[model samples]
Target chain A: MTKKIKETSNSETVVKTEEGKTLDQTVSALSSDAALFNREITQFNVEAETKKQRTATIVKNIFVYTFLTLCAIAAFLPFYWMIISSFKTEAEYRESIPTFFPRTFQWKNYSVVLSQTGAGASFGRILLNTLVVGLLSTTLGLIVIIITAYALARINFKGKNFLFALMLATMMIPGEMYTITNYITVSKWQWNDTFTILIVPFLVSVYYIYLLRNNFMQIPNSLYQAAKVDGLSDMGYLIKVMIPLTAPTLVSISLLKFIGTWNSYIWPRLVNIPDWRMISNWVTSGFTDSAGILGGSTSEALNTLKMAAVCMVSLPLFLLFIFCRKYIMHGVSKSGTKG
Target chain B: MPDKKDTLPQNDVNDVAGVEENVSNDAPQQPQAVKPSLAQKTKQAFADLGKKIKGVFVKDQVALIRDAGNTVITAEMLAGPQLSRKEKFSRFLHSQSGWLFVLPAVLLMCIFTFYPIINAFVGSFKQNYQATTGRFDGFGFENFVRVLKGDTGTGGATFLQCLVNTLVFTLVSVPLSTLIALLISVALNSIKPLQKAYQTVLFLPYLTNSLAMGAVFATFFTIIGTKSNPETPGLVNLALQAFGIAPIDWMGIGSPTWELGAISIPWAKYIVVIVYEVWSGLPFKILILFSALQSVNKQYYDAAKIDGASRSTILWKITAPMISPMISYLLITGIMGGMKQYSAIVGLFGEQMGIDYDMGTMVGYIYRYIEDGYTGYAFAGSLMLFAIIMVITAISNRISKKRVTY
Candidate 1:
C-alpha cells in the first residue's frame, strides 16, 4: 500500500521535471545574438547595483538588529528584575531608590518561602500538588485524545463528521460561560478540594483531539491496508503504525497540556482553596499572608520574599521551556498554520 | 487477476452455506450429534457466532474499500443473500465502533461541559438557587435584572461597569497587541541574525505564571514615596521622572481617573492592564504572523522590487494581504480571550478588585457573586457574558468573511 502511494507521487514529480526541462530549452532556443548582448548589458547593470544594494541591506539589518535587541531587552527585563529582586536583602530592596543589582544576596528568602506554611499547606506541598495534577491530567487526557483522533481519522463509521463538528462548535464558546455551572457540579459531587475536581473537568480537550486527528489523517491509508493484510487488528494498527508515526505530534500535545495544567489558575482557585491550592495560589495568597513574619514588618522585605517565591514557582516551567523549546514552538506554529 | 481474487470470498461463502446445511441434515439422524453435551453445545454456538460476526465484518471491509472509489464490486457480492440476525447485529457493532472510541470523551463532555452549560442557562433565571437543597425558589428575570442593575448588594461597580470595563479592555488591547505583534513579526522576519534568539526571548512571557508575573508588574508600578516625603518612586515613576514628569501613582488611591457621572475610568489601572495584556498576548500573535510572513511568496517581492515599489508599498500590498487571514483569526480569538480576562487582573489587584470591586471585569464580577453564594447572579452574569461573546463572534465572523483574503 505504501509503495503504491509513493510510486504515484514519484511519477508526478518526474512529469513535472520533464515539463520544466522542455520549457527551459524553448527559452534558450528563442534567444538571438542581439537579445544575448542586451541580456549581458542588463546583467552588468545588475552586478553594479548589487554593490549598492549590499550597503543598503547592511544599514537595514543594523536598524533591524538594534530594534529587535531593544524589544528583546524589554521583554526580558522584567524576568531579570524578578530574579535580581529575589536575591536582594530587605533593606536593599526597599532603599528609596531601587538598586538594579543586589548589594548583598539573601539566598535565605528561598529557604524561607519553601519552609513557610500558609493555610496548613506549605509551598513544597503546593508544588507537589501542581506536579501531580499536571502529570495526571495530561496523561489521561492524551489516552482519550489518541483513541478518538484515530477513530475519527482512520475508521469509517457513521456520524463521525457530525460528532467532530459538534466538538468543534464547543470550542467557539468562551470557557467563562461554563465555570459557574462547573463549580456547582463539582460542589454537588463533593469533588471540590480533591484532585479529582482538577483532573476530571478538563480531561477531554477538543483542540488536542483535532490536532491529533489532523496528524493521524496525514498518515497514508495504505499503511492501514497493509497492516490489515498482515493480520493486524484495529488497535494494533493504531498503536504500532499511527501512534509511532505521530510521536512528535503526541509529544507536542502532551507538553502543551502539561504546561496548560501547570499554568491553570481560575478553575483550581475556584474549586480548591487554601488546602488544595496549587503553586500559583500559593504565589498569590501565601506570600501576602507570610509578609509580616517573613518580611519583619518592612514592605521591602515582603516584596523581596514575594519575588523569591515567584522565581521558585516560575523556574521549573522556565527551564522546561528552555530545554524543550523546539517542541513547544513547533506545536504552536503547527496549530497556527493548520488553523 | 484482481477480479478473480474478489470472487474467492463469494465462493467461500457458498461453501460455508453448503456445510451448514449438511450438518443440520445429519444432526437428526445421528443421536450423538443431536444429544451433545452442554459444553460441546456451548462451544458449537460460540463458533457459529464467531463465523457470523466475521462474515459481517468481511462484508463491511469490502464495502469500505469500495467506498474509497478505488475498487469495483462484483454483481454476486452486491446482491448476495439477506443479512441474518447475527450478521445484522455484527454490522451494527461495526458501524458503532467509532462511537465506542469516542464514547469516553463524549460522555465526559456531556456531564461536565454540555450539561453544565445548559444548567447555567436555566439557573440564570432562578432568583435564589440553594446549593445545599439543590433547588431554586422560583424562575424569573430577577437574577438578570439585579445583576444588570448592579444591585448585587455588594456596593461595587454595577454590572454595567464591569461589562464596559471588559468591552474596553477587549477593544483596546486586542487591536493594540495585534498591531505591535505585526510590527515585531515583520521586523523579526526581515532580520537574518539571532532571529531564533529574539523569538525565544519574546515567547518567554507567554510561558510565565501570570500571577507571579503580575506580582513583578505590581512591583514595577509600586511607588516608594508618599506625598509628604516626595522621594524614591518605583521603576515606572523613575522612568517618567527622567523626562521631567511628576511621579504617577499607578495602582493606589491617588491613581489617575476620568469620571463622567456614575461611570469612572481608571486610567492608571487601564494602562497597567493593557500593558500586561499586550505583553502577554504578543508572543502568540507574533508566532502566527511571523510564519505567515515567512510563507509570503518570494516571487511577489521580486516583482514588486522590479517595479521599483517602496518598502512600505511592498509590505502593505504584497505582504499584508498575504497574511490578512491570520490577522483576522488572531483578532477574533484575541478579542474572545480578552473578554474572558480574570486571572491576570486577580494576580495584579487581588480578589476584591479594589475596596469594592472597582477594578472587577465581567468574569471577575461573576466570580465575586459566586464567592458570595449568589449562584443565580453568577449564572446570569455568565449568560450575559456568553451572549456578548456570541454577538462579538458573529460580528467578527461576518467581518472576516468579507475582509479576509483567504
Candidate 2:
C-alpha cells in the first residue's frame, strides 16, 4: 500500500497529464461568452469573478489593516509601558488606578541605578555581563547544535533511529527533572560563581537540534550529491551546502538561545550567590533587593528600579527585532514549523 | 520448498534415531522412518533430553577442550570481517577531518546537558550543607515527604500549594494563549499586505527573555499604585485615583469582599500576571501556529469558496481540522511548560517584594526548599511537580486526540 502511494507521488505523471490539457486556448475562445453566461456556469469566468471579488477583498484589506494596527498596539504596549513607567515619580505613580501615561519624568532613576559604585552590581556591568553570556552561550550552542543536527539529519550509524527518538523523548521530559542535579553538577565543578556556570550548562539543546535537522533534511539531495561529485566530504557538504541553506533557521535558533540566556534569572540566581553576581543580578536581584545586596530586603523603589532594569535588558532584543525583523521572522517561520 | 515441515520430522528425526541399525547393517545410513504415536512422541522427547544431559556429563576432557578451543577460534574467524569493518568505520569516524567536526559538540553537550542532569539528580538525593557536610545519608523519601507536607521548616508553606499554583497557572494560561494565538494567526493569515510585519511584531515577545520582561511588567504595575500613600509608583493606583476610585494594592493579597462597591478580587496583581504571561507567550504560539497554518493548502479554501461557503464556515470546516494536529502538539507542550513556569514569577516576586516569600506557584515552593537546604523536601516537591505536569500533559494529549481530526 505504501509502495503504491510512493510511486504515484514520486512519478510526475499525474501532474504532467493534467498540465498537457492546453486549456488556455479553449478559455480564450470562451472569453467573449463569459459576460453573456456570467450569471450561468462557464469555464472562462474566473478572472471576471475575481474582479467582482474586489469588494470583499477591499473590506478584508481594511479589516486586516485595522486588526494589525490593534495587534501592533497590543504587542508594543507592554514595552512602551515599561519604558514610560520607568520615568514616573513615586507620587504620580501612586494613583488608585494605574495611569496609561506618566505625569512626571523621573530620569534620576536611571542614574541612580547606574551610578552606584562599589555596589553589588551596576546597570552597566550587568548589561556587559548579559551581553557576554548571551554571545558566548549562543555561539557555543550554535556550533554544537549545528554539527550534531547535521550528523543526525544526514548520517547513518548504529542506533541512529533510537538516538533520534531519544532526543524527542528528552523533549517530553520537563527541564525541572534535572534542575537540582544540574545545580549540584555546577557546584561540584567550582563553576558556581563564574560565567562558565551561568552559560555553560545549556550548551546543546535537543529542540534546537531537532529544529535544525528538520530544516536541513528539507534541503535538496541534489545539492549534496553534486557536492559529493566535486570531492566534498560529508562535513564539507554540511559546511558548504546545508549551513547556507539552513542559515535562517540557525539565526532564529541562535537569537532565541541568546534571548533565553540573556533573560535567564533563575539559573543565575540558583547557581550564584550575592557575593558573586551577573548582569541579571543588577536588574532582577538588585532591583528587587531593597539594599541592593544579594539577599537583602525588598526595596520601596522596587517598581521603578525593576522597570528600569527590564527596559535595559529588553532594549537590545527590541532594537534587534526592529532592525532585523525580516531575518528574525524568516528564522521563526523556518524553525517554528511544528505548532 | 519441498514441504519440509511435513517430511522433515517424519523422515530425518526417525532416521537419525535409527542410524545405529543402519550402521550395523553396513547400509551407510541410506534412510529410515519411524512414525510415533502421540504417547510415543512424548516419551521420545523425554528420552532425547536425558540423552543430551548424559552426553554432556560423559564427555571426555581432552575432546571437550579441543571442541571448546575450536569453537572460540572459529567464532573469532567468523567475526574477523565484521571487526575489520567496524575498525575501518571507526577510523574514518575518528579521522582528523571528521573528528574535529564532531568533537566540539560532543564535548559541549556532555559538559552542559548530561553533566548538569546527573549533578542535579545527585544533589537532590544528597544532604549537602553550604559547600560543606557533603554527605549522602540514603535517607530515602525523607526529603520527598518533607516537601510534600510543607513541614521542612522553611516558613511552613507546603509544596502542595506550589503544585496547585503551577496547575492553575498552566490551566489558565495554556488554553488562553493557544486561543489568542489561533485568533491572531487566523486574522494574520487572511491578510495580504503587512502580514509579515504584523507577525514579526506579535512574535517579537516570544524571542525576548521572559525573566527580564517579567521584572519590567512588575515595575510597570507597581508604579501604577495609588498616589495618596504611595511609596511605590504603580499603574493600577494611578488609573484608579484618576477615575476617583480607590487604587488597588496590587502586589499584596487582598481581603475577599461580598458586598457591593467593595474589593472583590485581587484584580490588579492577577491582571498583571495574566497579561504578562499572555504577552510573553503569544509570540511563540503565533510563530508555531502561523507556520502550521501556512502549511495548509489554499486549495481547501478554494474548494470551500466554490461551494459558496462563508469565511467562518470555511475556517470551521477546513482550517480547524487541518491545524488540529499542530494544536494538539502546542496544547501538550504548552500545558507542560505552563505547569513548570517559574522564571517570570521569580523575576516578579523577587526575594522580598510580592506577597512575602511563600506565595509563588509550586516551583517557587520547591525553590524555597532548595534555598532552605531541604534537599529531601525539594526533591519531593520536584517529583510531585513533575508527576503533576506529566499527568496534565497526558490527559491533555488524550483529550486532544479525541478532538483532533487528523
Best by lDDT: 1
Residue B74 shift from truth in candidate 1, angstroms: 2.6
Which one wins on TM-score?
1
For residues B1-406, what per-residue lDDT tens digits would candidate 1 score against the true structure? 3332232234344533333443354345545546553223322332443322111223422211131243444323433555789999999898788888998999999987888888888888877887656788888999999887777786888889888888888899999999989988999988776888898888887677888888888888876658446445778887887899888888888888999776789988888888888888888898889988999889999999999998889888878888999999999988887888887887787766754788889899888887778888888898988889899989999999999875
| Chain A TM-score (model 1) | 0.79
- Candidate 1 residue A333 Cα shift, in angstroms, is 3.6
lDDT for residue A113 in candidate 2, whole number 0-100: 57
Candidate number with greatest DockQ: 1
**Candidate 1: pairs in clash:** none
lDDT of 1 by residue, A128-195 (tens): 88889899998999999999998889887888999999899888666777877888787878875568
Output the worst ten-in-a-row residue range by lDDT, candidate 2 chain B.
B56-65
Model 1 residue runs over 4 Å out of place are: A1-59, A286-295, A298-301, A334-339, B1-71, B225-227
TM-score of 2: 0.69
Model 1, position B328, has a per-residue lDDT of: 94
Reference A-B contact fraction recovered by candidate 2: 0.49
